[model samples]
Target: MTTIKGELLEGETETGMAAAAQGGQYGAAAERASEAKRALRLAVASSMVSKVCSIGLQAVSIPLFARVLDTDDFSAMMVYFGVTAWLSLVAIGIWPTVTSIAADDRRRGQLAGVLTVSWVGLSAIFASLIVLVLVLRPVLEQSGINLFSARHYSLFTAALVCYAMLTVLSVGEAVNQGQHRQHVNNLITAAGSILNVVFILLVTYFRPPGEEHVDVTLLFVASQAGFILIRVVNMIGVVVRAGWPHAFPGKAFARELARNSWSLLQAQLAVVFLQQGAVLLCYETDMPRDAALLALLFRANLLLHSFVYMINQPLWPIIHRNMLAGDWQWVIRIYRKLATCYVAYGLLAIIGAAFVGGAAVSLWTAGEYPISNKLATLCAVYFALLVTSAASTPVLMGAKAFVSLGNIGMAEFLAAGVLCTILYFADAVSFPHVVEALIAANAMTALWMMPTQAIVRLSRGSLDAQH
Candidate 1:
């Protein structure tokens, strides 16, 4: 650990230590500050490697998808992902809530208590979800909501079931994050990306022009098997490292987790609505091409954001730990630096979007799909607004300001929903119009409101610490 601190600190800015000293009452907790930095460095490094691997895999897989798959197939893929993203809502923020609780518990040597509660809660939720999916299957089928045609519905169902299992099992990931072992989770992610590339390669080789050389269902099964393998492996590692929960936690602790999860659920639901819901909206409005285009754009934006989030995500646990130690001053200083980086990245992304987004899309899709500069610029602006709000997300989450975050998310969701409804009634629900509504909604919440709320929460936390 000392060697790691020396190596990481050698490359780290002097600002953190300097800021710690300047933070007035850093207390005895100040001594552990270097350890936090070490953990954060590992998290960032692992995330970077994982993301870079994903980018490389995508560089190979996306063009194959664009060229090899029919429009229906491609659209089906997007819908599959969009629907799975919605599955996140089922957790109702339990995952992050558990992660936050686990971080606090680790400091107090009560990690087993939190883990046991999370396992019981998530397992029950998963079982309920299975029942829900089975019950809804017939209803949705009979409802005639044919996004992917009758033939592909079975494949879609299978894939979604696999993803549902993956989501529930992701408590393992939350466990690792709280323990500062994000590298293991990250490596598992890289392995998943590798599996994705292999799946794409199989598709490319077997699903050649005018002939189906491989059973598509078999490929799907293979992919799901790979996902289950990696996730289960990660889960086993987490249990070995953290140990099984010694005992089920008290009902009060469970209830508190539920309360926090409910608050965060609102935010998570809004996020899903803004992102995946938009793609589904395009499809429902009878705009298949628009749906495909928007999905592609969102995919591009997400790829860029993932790199930024690699740095941002490590902050959740680190800040939560510091906040528990009453190191509010250090938290505030770190946030200021993070906010600066967000602004800089947002500007550069906008510039890049204006100058090269369309060209980049065309190149990425091997000229299969071309986008306009206007659309590209709008996408960039939307992404900038979204990322800006995210600047304070970790800080707010760490501060346990769930209600404030939830309210902003609810506002943003309502704004987007109302505006989309208005556009639909006005017979003006075009691609650009939907994107514009999203931008407006995000501008209202993310651009200023979220950051302001974060500052307020930080101030309150600082005051409490001093008292």
Candidate 2:
């Protein structure tokens, strides 16, 4: 026993000095690595809970809104909502870039300034739109659309306010995302819905008792104002938390942000055209049935896709941090993992939507709106394919592979335009034609850029890690 002890002591002595120090260093590193992984797991769990909660909130909120608003009013409000949302992409294309820049140390202080510039720019555009809407008020009111009646002019103006408010809110969202505090955005969104409900009830209650039926236009505008109020409060909180750096727009800073954001905005425009342009096109072609179909499809898919975007909100900051840290290989590996997870989650959602969404939708609409399983199936398929881009594109964005992605986007836009034009000119256009266009466009883009180039690069391994 003594000899064994002696030998052990001798072995310890051999490994004790420099070897022991090296061993201790490795142990500390292992501990840090484990802690990081654990923290990541917690962040993911938090994100999932936030997403589920937000989606559940929307599910409940929509039905309640439907119950309150008459069909024509609800449809008109949605048109206002959808069109404003789709167009705001044009003005706030810099949000993703804001997030990317704010994720890093060098540009962290610049978020405030960038947001100021973006808000000013976007607000001006929205004001121009409001002026144009007012100028064309005569034409619109004569058009016989529910939103266009001279009586509903207040509602149209309110819708414009909603547009500007929502766009400005993106600045705060981008800040949260940059700091990996995306759950706060969800919390604010949930709060906004509550505020919306309260505002509607209050407006109804305060209306003169003789006029029990409050103007649908008033309800629409009030609810939008509620959203804006909540967003303003949240923005103040975020800025306070950030210690309110006076990021007054410096010339160079604005220019740099604009440069980085240009490609991002281009990407946004293309995506908006691909995903939400259906309704506009349908309306333009004078197909109200097709427009209605697109609206329902878009609303449902919007909720479903929210899960992906919610998860992605926390992911980009992590990627950006690593990119700045020069961890290229890690970024690729992370991208592949996230892409797989996103696609898998999307597939599960597709299956659920395809099999059951039609019946659920029919039940919700009381058979007044009987959507088919086949259409659900096709839309779900399109959604699943499209989600692959969420993780992929962010990786490209982090890698600053903007030029490559731009080329890819241009090709996709061209393909979509060609397909959609053909469909538009075709006799007796149907939802299937729209579905075909979506699937074809999504397939072309999703397959080529990240799934092909980025995934292959990851397989080959990261250049940074290799070097």
Candidate 3:
């Protein structure tokens, strides 16, 4: 009986040891998950703060510019800025391709090679285009309304080129982000924002308010130069920290990058057309005060959108990395958390804008232009739609469903563009009516696209797959 009891007791002891080991494993996993959540939350908070400050600075500057310059001057500046904005899409082609490619563990080196070559190619193209446009300025001026002088147009074109270079550097930032280098990326962005603020302050002080006091054209040129210098410095820092190779592209790597980039390029182009195309359409339509009104509304809308962008920006690389690794469960969790935060913040913003935007506008302009109820309401609605769109965009991006997103954007643009074009030519709707059309188009696109993309992502089991 003693021998039998000894063997039985030994078996029980072994069983207890196994159970303890299992419990420890579970505890470690839970702790790891908790840490990931905390890190993501911190990243999101940092992004939001940075974007808010940047957008707020721009918002403040607009009123100052309006006060210092006359309506015609402001409108002319808007046209010049619009041209540069459209060209930016062309100049920054294929850089975002680096983001998704770098996310793949097997392809990071090749992705880096592709990024190097693509950047050179795109930069050359942008430079050539800028030169061509500059050379043809006389013909361009004579053929149209010529909102700005040759000098101003040239400066705008230069700004666009510089912005393109910034876009290339942004790819490095994206790569760092994919590698979970959030802190480094945040530091660079924060520094860039500080530099921009300093530049803006200097511009304001040196330029001062008056028709004869400052050269608006020169101000923009100097600002663009400053922007480009800051971006170059930031890019150098990212490359140094990431140990990215400064080498030419490999043949296989270049091919792979091109393949991945096609979809992204399509999506980006569609977005460019959808957003900047509106400005072009407004210009073409010839509705009275259409450019000025659109610029004002767009500036306000962009500020709100920037806030949403800040919240979502950091998530992009994280999502890309996880999705590439087939970690769907984590992706879903992150998406849900981000969506909840965005919705809450969006609600607060809507309320604040509805209650105070009018008063703020009036004070900023010193009653030079009273905020109409219609304008205020339109701005609020636009911002609300932007928030909803922001909340859904990340899920779509993570699913590699950019093709569908591009299609949806194209459809929205076509619908709104057609309606606006008809109204402008027919003299049916006024400037406000065009704004209403745009708002309705954007909202409609979000309503259809967001749900569809979410369902597709869930159905593919892409959100829950493990790496």
Each model's TM-score?
0.88, 0.81, 0.82
Off by over 4 Å in 1: 1-27, 105-110, 131-138, 207-226
Mind giving the per-residue lDDT tens digits that candidate 1 earns over 1-467? 99999888875757676777666444566665877788888888899888987787768766766665677676666666666677777765667766775676543345666666666666777678667766777676666675545656676777667777787778888877777777777888889878867875776586657773344444455545555778888877766777656665577666777778788888887878887777888887777777887788777878889867787777778888888787888889888888888888888888998889889888888888888777788888888887887779988878778888888889899999999889889988777888899999988776788889889889998899778
Q: Please give the distance, in angstroms, between residue 284's alpha carbon in candidate 1 and its true position after superposition.
A: 1.4
Error of 3 at 414 (Å): 1.4
Candidate 3 C-alpha RMSD relative to the actual structure = 5.0
Give the clashing pairs for model 1.
none
lDDT of residue 18 for candidate 3: 85
By summed lDDT, which 10 consecutive residues of candidate 1 come out lowest?
212-221
Candidate 2 residue 253 C-alpha distance from true site, Å = 2.5
Query: Cα RMSD to native, each candidate?
Result: 8.4, 6.4, 5.0
Q: Write the per-residue lDDT of candidate 3 for residues 43-150, one digit (tens) a residue.
A: 767776666656655655566666665655566566565554555455333544566666566766665556566567767876787678778878876766544355
lDDT per model, in order?
0.76, 0.68, 0.62
C-alpha lDDT of candidate 1 relative to the true structure: 0.76
Screening candidate 3 with a backbone cut-off below 3 angstroms (N, C-alpha, C), the clashing residue pairs are 325-467, 328-463, 328-464
Candidate 3 segments whose C-alpha is farther than 4 A from its true place: 1-39, 91-93, 145-151, 207-213, 242-256, 259-261, 284-288, 344-346, 364-369, 462-467
After superposition, which runs of candidate 2 have C-alpha atoms over 4 Å from their true positions? 1-46, 64-71, 109-112, 139-154, 200-214, 242-251, 456-461
Clashing pairs in 2: none
